[model samples]
Target: MSNPGSYPLPDRFDAVLAEQDAEGYRCRFAPVALSDLPDRDVLVEVRYSSLNYKDALAVTGRGKIIRQSPMVLGIDLAGRVVSSGSSRFRPGDAVVVTGQGLSETEWGGYSPWQRVRAESLIPLPPAFSLAQAMGIGTAGVTAMLSVMALERYGLAPTPRPMVVTGAGGGVGSMAVALLARLGYPVAAVTGRAALHDYLTQLGARQVLDRSALAQASPALGNERWAGGIDSVGGKTLAYLLAHTAAHGAVAACGLAGGADLPVTVFPFILRSVGLLGISSSSTPAAAQTQVWRRLARDLPASVVDSISRVEPLSRIFELAEEILAGGVRGRIILDVRA
Candidate 1:
């Protein structure tokens, strides 16, 4: 069946909505009508969306990721412009909308229909399908940015390993895949020995256990890494700092482990190690465009399929439970129209 005044809809328009339960947490979506959507500048008929750790937390009510009640839960949306009020885009324009507080401060892309602010819209990269763009999503963008930061600081082909903490997770996996595709020797750090094989397939030449770093104190440790992409934060970052080779760089993201880093100044003071902070929120538009272009050109075609898991919007409630429990693998792309 066609939607009342927008794109085609089947018998139902699938979406994931979160509501606060008296007991604790709850999420579900009924057959939402298009006319029932909140008003905004551009009405996007979302075809595909993707999850990040933030989306997981928002769906579960575990962290305060969602600021409003009865919210749709999805952070990244890739879809066609069903209609638009802005001059910049018109009907049928492909777009990637992400990280403008979707599923957090506002209703987001879990719905098949969404009203997005036109200014937040980004035209899809020419090299990607709408689904493929969502498959990469915010995680891939952040990963590319981290790798870009390292490359900016002279991460070259060297005998020393470039360690990636939390290598089994989304950003870490993409980082591993991107770095390896670019001819860097990547060492993935994960406590899950089982994912060693999986990480290896994603381009990690070696895998290190998280606990091995926990026992070592780091004014300086083994001059192990040429550089690193540390997504786990906390002690993992401290360890990476201690272990990075002389004059090496590390792009610090995520706080999966914890935010606290108990460290001394030895790595920076003695080794001239560089700790580069890669932030997505304040990244310049031109730089963002540059990074996306790099990802389109360099990320292997196989990596899109290799690092992604597909799920329906209705499954997000359960998916969040798994993410919080640290049981999810790779990138999980949400099929919003299903």
Candidate 2:
């Protein structure tokens, strides 16, 4: 094990902690001692973490994202190793950790310092800096995973166009950019009309109002798209399934809209539409590596910068409210070290 004294380790660091009290659940930025962290194989000095829908939900107490109390509350982090017990990593190694039950069952990334299992960390790809890696973060990984699922199902780029729901959010924005960069026409769907121009700037060929697909979808509607990456579940997912072209596939990654599936199996029986579920939190290590590699190759840093902004970790609560209110346009990177 590397000597922790070799690094300029802080006795205490700031983190966003969520806990349930006699009063109620509360999330706040507080100082945490290094010893308070779990006894994991690697001690990381987190440089950047990104705000995701899940993080917002947890911080705002809107969703039961934190299964454990006194939990750190950021799902994605990019940083450098300060000390390591495993041979796979040494002090000063750059790494990224996303999902793997972060902010839920395990302590997560909303801290300047955190102890993580070595297996949960991925060496930062040479294509991205620590900040850039967080910019892609959990959301990018989910979007890439969705695209890979669609491709594995034999869906390809074509003139039929691919739809991305919740297009103003992190995953949807990344999906729009990824699909468009892969030569597929992208129709970005958002509830906020103000984000139309922003979505287009992220490579959306067309931007549609959320109401276009948020209504009560029939069992089978006209084939409007070849396929899609859906982050909004419920009506939006139902609509995608109902209108997807024959043999098309829809990758469902989130339920920001709602969780219920209101449509029947007509789309599946009549059109052979495949609904692929993407659970990014528990994706295997090998698949996570593949997703990162694909993201490095396909997602340009410039586009990432255009769609993302950096904010201090102190503003996490305000940002969480903004995200939940559907006011945030793209990804928000938390400068943990700030």
Task: Judge candidate 2 against the unseen true structure and give its global Cα lDDT, from 0 to 1.
Answer: 0.89
Q: Could you say which candidate leads in TM-score?
A: 2
lDDT per residue (tens digit) for residues 157-230 in model 2:
98998999999999999999999999999999988888878888888889998887889988888998999999
Candidate 1 C-alpha lDDT tens digits along 77-175: 988887788998888888887677788776788888888888778888888887778778888888999988888887787878899988888888899
Please give the distance, in angstroms, between residue 273's alpha carbon in candidate 2 and its true position after superposition. 0.3
Which residue pairs collide in model 1, if any?
Answer: none
TM-score for each candidate, following the candidate numbering:
0.90, 0.96
Candidate 2 Cα deviation (angstroms), residue 13 = 2.0
Q: How far is candidate 1 from the true structure (C-alpha RMSD, Å)?
A: 2.9
Question: Once model 1 is optimally superposed onto the true structure by TM-score, how far is the C-alpha of residue 48 displaced, in angstroms?
Answer: 1.1
The lDDT per prediction is 0.81, 0.89
How many clashing pairs in candidate 1?
0
